[model samples]
Target: MISGSIVALVTPMNADGGVDWAALERLLELHIEAGTGAIGAVGTTGESATLSVPEHCEVIKFCVDSVAGRIPIMAGTGANATREAIELTRAAADAGADCCLLVTPYYNRPTQRGLYAHFRAVADAVDVPQILYNVPGRTAVDMDNEVVAELATHRNIVGIKDATGDRERGRDLIARCGDEIAVYSGDDPTAMDLMLAGGKGNISVTANVAPRQMAQLCALATAGDREGASAINELLTPLNSALFLEANPIPVKWAMAQQGLIGEGIRLPLIVLDEQYHADVRAALEAAGV
Candidate 1:
């Protein structure tokens, strides 16, 4: 299993909303140098919803080529449409991505059977290893544990990024499907606890800003070192909460820009972080020593 902190990277953009290729390359190098286990290119944090199909595939290919097999690349290939999901997954595989993360169909609110069929169809169509993403708060469709366990039986379905943030439910999912597939925490604040409960790793947004620290925390937590992990998690908890202050990349992008990692560019429907939360976020970053 690909373990440790897998950064859900942000797609750096120019002020004109164009993908900043230079910044993207720098960010990739940043994660690799920081010892991030993998890079989740074009995932939610990467603004998968906004990128065009060609851009999405191009980003994945860019990451794969830039990394040069140094570490695994988990491409975000999920879509609300089954055909699009399959096409994206195929594109990622062709781009030589190590794996793909497919979020549940958003706005579709697929039933359990529909969810199973949707994921299965993609897994069957593409040969790449697939990781299921369950973030109902964003997608509005929840994949039940029983349904997830059923899908885990597929040879190509290697893992699930459970972003539910409910430790009890996460523990139950681990017990139910841990034997069949690796479980990864997609929720940052509760990530350490989930890892200590046998989660393989974390698909994290926090790593976008504090890659080195998040990587260290994941290593400690997954290795069963509660004290070491707790120390880091406690420090990161505030930043983790702060990042979600206005939904995902909004805050994380601002945080990254503050550190001079990227520019102040966010796509439409999602503007820059509010000035009101600036002090609080900056304080959190300072507290976490980012």
Candidate 2:
């Protein structure tokens, strides 16, 4: 089980909107020192959509190299196009990522059968461990738990990152899959609850700035120490809410920049965090001890 607090890391960029290689290495080192369980590179938070294929592959490669086996890496290799997803997953595996996180095919909104087939195809093609990412809010397509259960049987499909933030859905998925597959919470706000309820871990955006706290919360929750975990989670609630004040990585990138974790560059189609929300986010970060 790829369990614990795994960060959906952001791609640091320069003022000109290019990847900041130095900052990327700095962020990786911070996570390593803070005991982050795993790193999910080129994820939505990492702005995978805007990056070209070569850039995407390079980011994952750079992350794999940067982590230096200090922690596991779950490379984001998903694409709405099945073939592209397969190729990325193959590349990630070749680059020595421990696993691949493949999100549901977006825009086209494929049927449940198509979702299963899509994931299965990638798993079969890559021969690498795969984690199904179902963030319907972003992808416009959700992989039903039934389909997830079916895919859980595939040899290489090991788990699902349920980002729906629905406690019932998380519990149901965990129940249905049993021990065959792991259930990870992709939503930070509800992560502790899901972990206490049988989730194997959290693929967290909040962990980008609050890695140690997130890691500690995951440990408590995974141990079924509900009370202990809840205490830690209370400290993080503000951060969880604030990071999504805008469509993620926007607010997160700004907060990280303020903390000197990364530079202030965010690409187009997605702008920097709005000024109006700055003070509130700053307060949240201060409150969370981030």
Candidate 3:
């Protein structure tokens, strides 16, 4: 089972917004050595929104090569356009990705019917395993549980990364679809609770700095040891909230830089973490024992 702390890894970049290929390899090796369960390359945290299509594919190929079968690799092939998403997913499959984490199309706010059609189109088009990403807060459209259950029946649609952080909804989703698909927590704070309720794993941001802890937590929670998992979860609570101290990769990129895991570069439209949040993020990292 591909169930554990799958880090939504941040792609390393230079301050000038150039893709730092050297730094990228270092980040991949760090996770592989730290025992991270899987890697989600070029997703939101990797600045996927800012990269051109070639750059996006380039990053995915680099991740696939850098990891070299050491760990599972899920490429961020989601796009606002169904055709574009299908094209990217096909390319990722060609690049040897284990699966594709396709987010709900953003900006256009596709309906439940549209969402189903969008994903089904890709599933029919690609033979690789596919994980649906439902982050309504970012995508503007919330895929209802029924929609997810419907999609779960597809041969190639394998699982979902639910980012809503709503436990009740997550539980219902699992009850409806768990037998057919994997239910992964995309929100770090509630991830343990979701796992305790039978979530398969966490596609985590907190794992960026606390991989070993998150991996342990996932193992414990998946194994039904709530007390042990919660102990680690409580310790990681500060980081769960603090990482969003700014928009995603902004704060995470900064945290990674602090530990010298990656350079402090971020793309424009998004910048480095604000000065005010620096000390707070640092304190949170310290609290997580990073």
What CA root-mean-square deviation does each model show from the true structure?
0.6, 0.7, 0.7
Candidate 1: clashing pairs of residues = none
Q: What's the lDDT for residue 24 in model 2? A: 94
Q: Which stretches of candidate 3 lie over 4 Å from their true place?
A: none
> What's the true lDDT of residue 239 in model 3?
91
Order of the predicted models by lDDT, top scorer first: 1, 2, 3
Worst 10 residues of 3 by lDDT: 26-35
Residues 1-290 of candidate 1: C-alpha lDDT, one tens digit per residue:
89999999999999999999999999999999999999999999999999999999999999999999999999999999999999999999999999999999999788999999999999999999999999998999999999999999999999999999999999999999999899999999999999999999999999998999999999999999999999999999999999999988999999999999999899998999999999999999999998
Estimate TM-scores for all models: 0.99, 0.99, 0.99
lDDT of 2 by residue, 1-290 (tens): 68899999999999999999999999999888988899989999999999999999999999989888989999999999999999999999999999999999999999999998899889889899999999999999988899999999999999999999999999999999958998999999999989999999999999998999999999999999999999999999999999999998899999999998888999999999999999999999999987
- Model with the higher lDDT, candidate 1 or 3: 1
Question: Which regions of candidate 1 are displaced past 4 Å?
Answer: none
In model 2, which runs have C-alpha deviations exceeding 4 angstroms? Answer: none
Q: Summarize candidate 3's per-residue lDDT along 98-182 as a digit string, tens digits.
A: 9999999999998899999999999999999999999998989999999999999998999999999999999999999999999
How much lDDT does candidate 1 score?
0.95
